[model samples]
Target: MTIHTETIVDNGVNTEALIGARGAFTEMPEAAAFTFRSTCDWVSGTESSNAINGYFGLGQEHEREETFTIASDHPAVFAARDTAPTPPEIVLSALASCLTGGVAAVAQHRGIQLRKVQAIVEGDIDVRGILGMDPDIRNGFNSVRVRFEIDADATEEDIRALVAQSQKRSAVFDLLTNPTNVHVDLA
Candidate 1:
């Protein structure tokens, strides 16, 4: 006989535990607020590396399982070494990751099992703005698109609704769609 813990995992999410957490957060809404941070350092030739390991959540500090590092660099056309993915690519990745996680969580909560999830994310950018060739142009992607191919134990309408709900709850999606105040000064 196989033994199983009390955890009820569906689509890789602990549905039972999450339900309990939802109740806790509902009672103490302040605990639901979380702050995430990442530190980045410039390497050379438009190359930079970032590290993330700690965050504050549930009214307390928490550390990640391990330090995660990411590297970004510009292409050679911009006199860069093209060492790693570009920063914009990383943003797309973050969006995809957040959406995918939301999908899994939502599926688990709805008792839907996911078999496969694939996504293709793309962004359209014009370098003229960043290069200062046109002041009127924006220095970011003009548009971003994400297409998902998900195989789950649910109807097509349900899957579509799952993806839609994921987008509605995705932090990264909101960050990209809305404006955020950013301050950078000499430290």
Candidate 2:
């Protein structure tokens, strides 16, 4: 199939330039080698809250330092006050944002103009697993669902295709679908 390329400028994204960059990366794989790092420190005397800080650039360009706080608590069961969203909720937010970004990029690349796009992400989890009440159950979300409400001029079929393509290209989706090695140690 012949890919018709069009220049799309919306929301600070240049689709034509993005497609060109992607083609360049396909030719030079080393150009795509990027590492992302972040550090999270525990806040307060308890372990209910954490302060996360990280830079938001690819490769050697560290860019700017971004910081945010996350917390979790139970009303009376855990003896802590609920302040911010739990870490799992933060993961859901990340997934939603990543998927939304992918959708926007794909739409732009396809020459489709979008009026608005919204995503709702939900994950099902059983507290018993984390509480050790059910040893057979996993300690994380059993399943996740993402629903998108997109307003665009494209046909429904084309919109569905856009979503599918976005899922295929989303980095966060790949990270959640694939296994990643993580190591931890006392400092």
Candidate 3:
């Protein structure tokens, strides 16, 4: 198939650029290594704000067009104002976002024209774990579930494969499914 570098737009994604990136990564796999950074500051009682703007990827430093900030707060039941979703809620949303983007990108790459795509993500967590009420319970989600509703010019089997492929490629899914090493220290 003929590809136009500047004109192949699918699902609002630059397919040509994506293809170029795939080729580049295939040639120099190290370019795929990326480090993401975020800074969070305490705002008030159980409230914090996070800033995301810079990262290193494709063997170069990259900055976003604008800094994105998200504020988080605990619910009133937790003795804090319910002004914003808690950090756990943010995690759930981020997982949903990653999977949904992957689905769209995979669809575009496979030449599927999508009419609509929606995902509902839910995480089950026992607050007693975070509350220190149960030592046996983990302080994280026990499980996460995602449901996708996709309308596309593909069969149901194809749609299922698309979502499955998305999950297989999603970094967030891997992170959540596997154990990751984390270190916290006084700086």
Highest TM-score among the candidates is held by which one? 3
**Residue-wise lDDT of candidate 3 within 1-187, one digit each (tens)?**
9976643436876667988988999999999999999999999999999999999998999999999999999999989987899999999998999999999998888888888999999999999999999899999999899999999989999999989999999999998998899898988
lDDT of 1 by residue, 94-157 (tens): 9999999989999988878899998889999999998899999999999999999999888999
Task: Tell me how far the alpha carbon of residue 186 in candidate 1 is from the true structure, in angstroms, after superposition.
Answer: 1.6
- Identify the superior model by lDDT, candidate 1 or candidate 2: 1
Error of 2 at 145 (Å): 0.7
Q: Rate residue 39 of model 3 by lDDT.
A: 95
Q: What C-alpha RMSD separates each model from the true structure?
A: 4.4, 4.4, 3.9
Q: For candidate 2, lDDT tens digit of each residue in 1-187? A: 9999865536445777887878988888676676656556566433465555544332344544656656754443556455556677878888998989888888877778888899999999898898899899998899999999999868999999989998998888887888878789998
Better of 2 and 3 by lDDT: 3
**Best-to-worst lDDT order:** 1, 3, 2
TM-score of each: 0.91, 0.81, 0.91
Residue pairs in clash, model 3: none
Candidate 2, residue 34: how far the Cα is off, in Å: 1.4
In model 2, residue pairs whose N, Cα or C atoms come closer than 3 Å (at least 3 residues apart or on different chains), thus clashing, are none
lDDT of 1 at 29: 100
